[model samples]
Target: MSNRVINILVPVISILLGLLVGAIVMLFSGYDPVNGYIALWNGIFGDSYAIGETIRQISPYILAGLAVAFAFRTGLFNIGVEGQLMVGWFAAVYVGAAFELPMIIHLPITLLAAALAGALWGLVPGILKATLRVHEVIVTIMMNYVALHVVNALIKTVSNGSYKTEKIQPTASLRSDFLSNLTDYSTLHYGIFVALAMVIVMWFILEKTKTGFELKSVGFNENASQYAGMNVKKNIVLSMVISGAFAGLAGAMEGLGTFGSMTSLGGFTGIGFDGIAVALLGANTPLGVIFGASLFGSLKYGANNMPNAANIPLEIVSIVVALIIFFVASGYIIRVGLQRLKKKKEAK
Candidate 1:
């Protein structure tokens, strides 16, 4: 199968398999799988409220997925995406709250601060890898904890030990009450457009630009790239910075669009690590990441709604997500299934 086809189909099969296995597990546990799934579906897609939630969920998943996909292309494992995201969230919240500028100026400024902060956070691991010969995976992992502690401390200091920052100015906020007219109650915003734009922009750069070729070359063979006079160190740092920027934007979306402001919202923000699964499932392409993110987002959004209506637990979503990750990581099974599917079709 072609990479494109596998990229498109693998996630679909993985999701179906996950749901099937989840149903089995539910049955064994004495729970009605159907009712649980029904409730979940209602939670995110049953009503206008659910649709809004679905779009809201997609915001973070999109950027975080892009973060991982970008780093993967450069042969870097940015475990520090969480850290970068945290710092970016902090910067956006802090700057957004501190300022009272016009909407046009405030919005861009807050977003830029987030991107810059994330880039700075990523630059650390990048430098460590380039100059100290440290493995980015290790550095990024440690940095996650470092960033958490640092942000926790900052939040405490700012709010006199409070757990969160105050709400941002209206100009900096992304929500539209007009959306409330469309849906009774929904937190979804137009920030999803920004995520989509980023996906397209990232895809263009990686597929059609010289810089992208340089980064991919380094990923394929650092030694060969260096021999070919490519700047390996530069590319490594650049990749990390770009990856971190994406993560930052993800957190920013949550703060500005979904949550209305940034609160001390990191300890439980598993979205960074979740991006790994999203990237792998999508085969690390920009377009693929968007679809992967949307799938995961929908399941999460949908599962929440199912519980209220069907007496099902929302935690099923987590199990389903885990299964999707596992299958995507081991993709040969998908290839085998495709081959069998083709053979059966040919026979028919």
Candidate 2:
């Protein structure tokens, strides 16, 4: 089989294996796997509200996946997306609640503020990596804590020691009355359009731009790119900034669309961490990220129905997701097995 075919086949096979394993686990636990699966399916697609909510949930995942995928493409592991997203959320809400500009200006400015905040947060680790050879993973992990504490402090300062901020003004909101009504009063918003636009932007930058070539070349080999007259350090920093911008946009989805406010968190949101899985499942491609995000979003949203509809525990869905991720991570083994099978067929 061709490499492209193999690439596609790996994930498909992994998904099937995951579901099969999940079924076995359900059987061992004395629950009906069929009912669990049916509940999962219905939760995602049973009603207009469910579909709308699923789409809303997916919008941020798409951006989060893009953030991680962008960094991976440029040979960077940005674990700071959670921190960046937190800061972005705070920045967006701050702007949205403070300003009273017209919709055309207020919304764009609020969104831009969020992206800028994320980019700035990402810049520190990028600079350290490029100039001092510090490992991004270590720096980013520490930064996550910094972002969390700092944002929480800022929230309390702004909200007079409250845990949440004020709701954003109407002009800065992404909510759409028409869409809400169409979806039976779901929280779906215009953030989906922004997420889709960024997908195209990522594709264009990676596939059609000169900067993209330099970034990829640098990622493949810094020494070789430098020898070929590319600015490796610059590309590295730029890649992180761009990745951070995508992460920030994800925060905007929550602040400007879903919640229209910011809240102090006792712990991590897990969305940024989930981006790692999404990027892995996507094969680190722009188009692939959407598919990964959709699968993840649907599974996460649908998982809620298992308990109510099938008497199955919610933890079962988590186990299934974990198994799926494990299979995806074991793609090398699958590929090797496929290659051996192909060789045997050719020998015959």
Candidate 3:
């Protein structure tokens, strides 16, 4: 079989295996897998509202997944997406609340602030990794806590004892009345258009641009790329900066589109963490990440209705999602199996 064929088969088979195992587990636990999945499907697709909500939830996941995937393609582990996202969220909201301008200027400025904040947050770890030879994973993980506390403190100071900032100016909001009316007042917003545009932008950059080639080549082999006269260190830092920009845009989606305000969090939002799983499941590609995010988003939206409809635990959905991720992570085993099967057919 061709490698492309194998690539497609692997993820498909992994998804099937995950669903099969999930069904078995549900059955063993005295729950009807049929009804459970039916409930899930209905929740995601039964009506326009469900569909809109699923898309709304998945929009940020797509951006977050892209953030992680972009870093992975450049041979970097950006565990700091969570922190970057938080800072971006705060920056966007702060700008939106503090400034008053026309929509044309106000919206772009707020979004750009988020992207810059996220990029700056990511650049620190990238610089450390390149100049100081520090492990990005550790630095990023530590930075997550630092960002959380710093943002929490800032919000508290400005919030007049509240845990969140005041509502953003109307011009800075991403809400669209047309989309809301179409979706039956669901939380779906104009951010989906931005998310989709980013997907296309990412695909173009990675597949059709020279900068993308340099980044991917460095990820594939840094020493070889350097020997070939590419600035490996520069590419590494640039890659992280680009990846963080995507993550910061994700925060903008939440701040400007979903909430229109910034809130103090007691803990992480987990969106960035989920991006790790998403990138893995999607094989670290822009197009694949959209599918992965859709699947995850559907499962998340569906899980809400599963308990009331099936009397099953919500954790079951999480377990199934985890199993899917595990199967995707172990894809090498599936690839080997496919290779053996191909060899047998060729021998005949």
Ranking by lDDT: 2, 3, 1
lDDT for residue 27 in candidate 2, whole number 0-100: 91
Write the candidate numbers in order of decreasing TM-score.
Answer: 2, 3, 1
- Model 1 alpha-carbon drift over 4 Å, by segment: 1-12, 313-317, 324-331, 340-348
lDDT of 2 by residue, 163-195 (tens): 999999999999999999999999999999999
lDDT of candidate 1 at residue 100, scale 0 to 100: 95
TM-score of 1: 0.91
Question: Over the stretch 1-348, how does candidate 3's per-residue lDDT look in tens digits?
Answer: 988999889888987897789889889888998998888788899788888888899988998999999999889999899999899999999999999999999999999999999999999999988888899999899988998999999898888888989999999999988888898888899888888899998889889999999999999998999999999889989998999999999999999999999889989999988888878778899988998888777877877877888888977877866776678678889999999999999999
Q: Rate the local accuracy (lDDT) of all candidates.
A: 0.83, 0.91, 0.89
Candidate 1: clashing pairs of residues = 39-306, 40-302, 40-306, 43-305
**TM-score of each predicted structure versus truth:** 0.91, 0.95, 0.94
Q: What tens-digit string does per-residue lDDT give for candidate 1 at 95-131?
A: 8889899999999998889888889999999999988
Clashing pairs in 3: none
Regions of model 2 farther than 4 Å from truth: 1-8
> Any idea what lDDT model 1 has?
0.83
